[model samples]
Structures are given as C-alpha cells and as structure tokens.
Target: MADINIQRKKSSPSPWLLILLVLLGLAAVGYYVFRADSDQPVTTAPAVPSPEPAPDSTTGAETAPRPTNDPAVADMATEEPGGSPDELAAFAASDASAPNYGRRGLEMLMASLRPLADRDDLRDATVSEKRDDLTSATSRLQEQGTSLRPGYVAAANLIKAMQQKAYPALEADAGELVNRANALSGRTNTAQEQQQVRDFLSRAAEIVRALNQPAQ
Candidate 1:
C-alpha cells in the first residue's frame, strides 16, 4: 500500500437535497405570512337601514276628527254661506218650508225694500240712495245661494232688473216686481215667509203708486 492515505473530502449536500431545503423554507415563509394575516381581527361594516315613508297632506288623516253634528263647527268648515240662488228660489217657491237660512234672507231683503219703497220721494230719490238700496237687497239675496242650496234666482233677477233702471224706470217696473214677489210667496212652506214676501210686494207696489202721485 502506498504511504498516501486516501482522505475523504468533506461531503457537500446533493443538488436535490438543496432544492428540497429551499422549497421547505419557501413553504414555511408562506405559511407564516398566511398565519399573520389570519391572526388580525376581520372588520366587516354594519348594514344600513332604509328610511320610513311620509304621510299624506290633503286628507288631514293624522289630525283629530271634526264635529259634524255641531252647527258652529259645521259653519267653521265652509268659508262662504251655503245654498244656491236657484235652489233657494225653488225652495221659497215650493210648498216645502224654506230653510232657516233662506227664510231669514227673505226677511233681510224685505227690510231693505221697505225703506226704499216707503220713502216720501222715491221717484225723486237720488241715484246714490237708489244704489245703496240696491246694494243692500242684492247682497242679502245673493247670500241665499251661497250655502250650496238653490238660491233665489228668480228674485235675484228681479233685483238685478231694478238695479239696471233709473229711479223713474224702476218705479215703472214696480208692478211687475210685485208680481214676482207674489210668485215667490206661492212657493213658501210657512205663513211668515209668505207674509214677508207679500210685505215686499206691497212695498214695491207702494213705490210705483207713489211715483204716479205727483210730488206731494
């Protein structure tokens, strides 16, 4: 045997072993990154709720109930008085009793007519005075038609005719006006309403008759 001793070089890792170690190291690193990410708290946002619906305006459903039975309350509900001119006239002309509202309206019209007819100088009456009388009578008569009931349409026409005429001309039409008033009386349910209409006719007649009497 030669004196040279066979010395074994220190063994190096095989290429396959190095590759396996590198793959293991990479896998450990990936696992650690995944575990770190997983350890943190998962924050999810809370869900938002939808809004509620609004109420209606026109019906006033949310408000307290109104008192329909009370007269004062009923009056408060409407801005204008009830009854129509035609209906009021028809009612007055009918055998059925005129509603309190219409009956009262007749009384008011008669009141205004009385002063105009009873005037000593009706034919010679100033146009201003005649206009005032016209205004008062027409306003009251018009009110009869306001509350949704038929109003004194017939009587309103008579009033309108009177308003269109001169004092002397109105005096000439008084007889015809009287006829209209009497016609209104025939439609009334109550003696009082009829009598009121008659009184108005009588005053209209007086106005006409006085016009013929030559200034006293």
Candidate 2:
C-alpha cells in the first residue's frame, strides 16, 4: 500500500481578532471627527442696536442725552424761561412782589415803545395809537398795590417822558434804561432772568438807535 502524505490545512484568522481590529478602526475615525469639530471657532449671536433719542418739541431738533446729575444741565433745566408775552405783561403789571415783576415790567415798556420809536413822524395818528398802548401798560403797573422796584419805576418814568413829548429828555436819559437793566441783571439768580433783562436791553437799544437817526 502506498503511504498517502496528508497536507495539513492552514488555520484561518480568529473571528474575535478581526472584530477587535474593526472596533479599533471605528474608534480612531470617531476620535478624528470629534477633533475636527473641536478645532472650529464657536459662533455667537449678533448684538442689538440702540434706539435713537427723541426730538425737541419747540425747536424741532434732536437733543443729545445729558447726564441727570450734571450741575450745568440741572441749572439749564431749572432756569428754562416760562410764559408768553401776554402772561409776562400781566405779571409785570400785577404787583411788585410778583415773580419777575421788574423784568416783565421793563419788557412790556420796551415792547410798547418799539413801534413808536421806529416811526418817522412822532405826531402821526399811529403815535397816538402806540401811546395808548403804553398808557394802558403804565396804568396797570400803577394800579398794583405793592411798592415798585427802582428799575421798574425808572422804566415807567421814561415812558412818561415819551408821553409828554420830552424828546430831549428821552435822548439824554435813554441809556439809563440799559444801565438799570444791567444792574438788575447782575442781581438775577438765574440765567433765564438775566436773559430776559438782556432782551429788554436789546429792545431799549433799538429805541435809542431810532431816536438817534438823522431827521429826514
């Protein structure tokens, strides 16, 4: 009998070893993907825009925001001018103790005299009409029960001089109006009062200019 040589089959790779290799490969791939994600920059939400400031009602302009605690701003707010011409006139003619009495009285007097001062004819019917207004203003001031300030009295006296056709006196003493106004302004506690006095002086200066104009 011929002796048959049996060839031994080579053993296949273990299933558990193959499974372990696949798991290791999957873990490495997952770790690389996670690392790629971690390397990117984080995103943030966009910022919201601020709202605009409101406009000023009187001037029709936009006003900038001011600090509430700022002393200058506080003073400006506190000293803001109040009332209309009619109201100021009433206050001026009411009483000596009235708020802004002297200032308002002077303002009213200056306002009444402005039109008459600008006229070319002192004896025109328009002069009488304007003088009537001045008379009415002075009458109210005189009717007030309280004693008047020297500044207000001086203004009234000047108006009286105009009523009496004392042109020379008016010309010579017109500067006294501004001088008294300046003195009163210096005594003012607020910018608003000082400003009112300044306005009175400006109007008084215009009257002086009209008085000084060359005769036609």
User: 103, model 2: CA deviation in Å?
Assistant: 5.7
List candidate 1 stretches off by more than 4 Å: 8-11, 57-182, 185-216
| Residue-by-residue lDDT tens digits, candidate 2, 33-88 | 99999999999989898876555555566467545976435433432243334444
Q: How accurate locally is residue 110 in candidate 2, as Cα lDDT from 0 to 100? A: 49
Error of 2 at 2 (Å): 99
* Cα lDDT over the full model 1: 0.47
lDDT of each candidate versus the true structure: 0.47, 0.51
Clashing pairs in 2: none
lDDT of 1 by residue, 91-197 (tens): 34444344553455444343444333344554344433553443344444434333311223333344433434434455445555645554553344567756555
Error of 1 at 14 (Å): 2.0
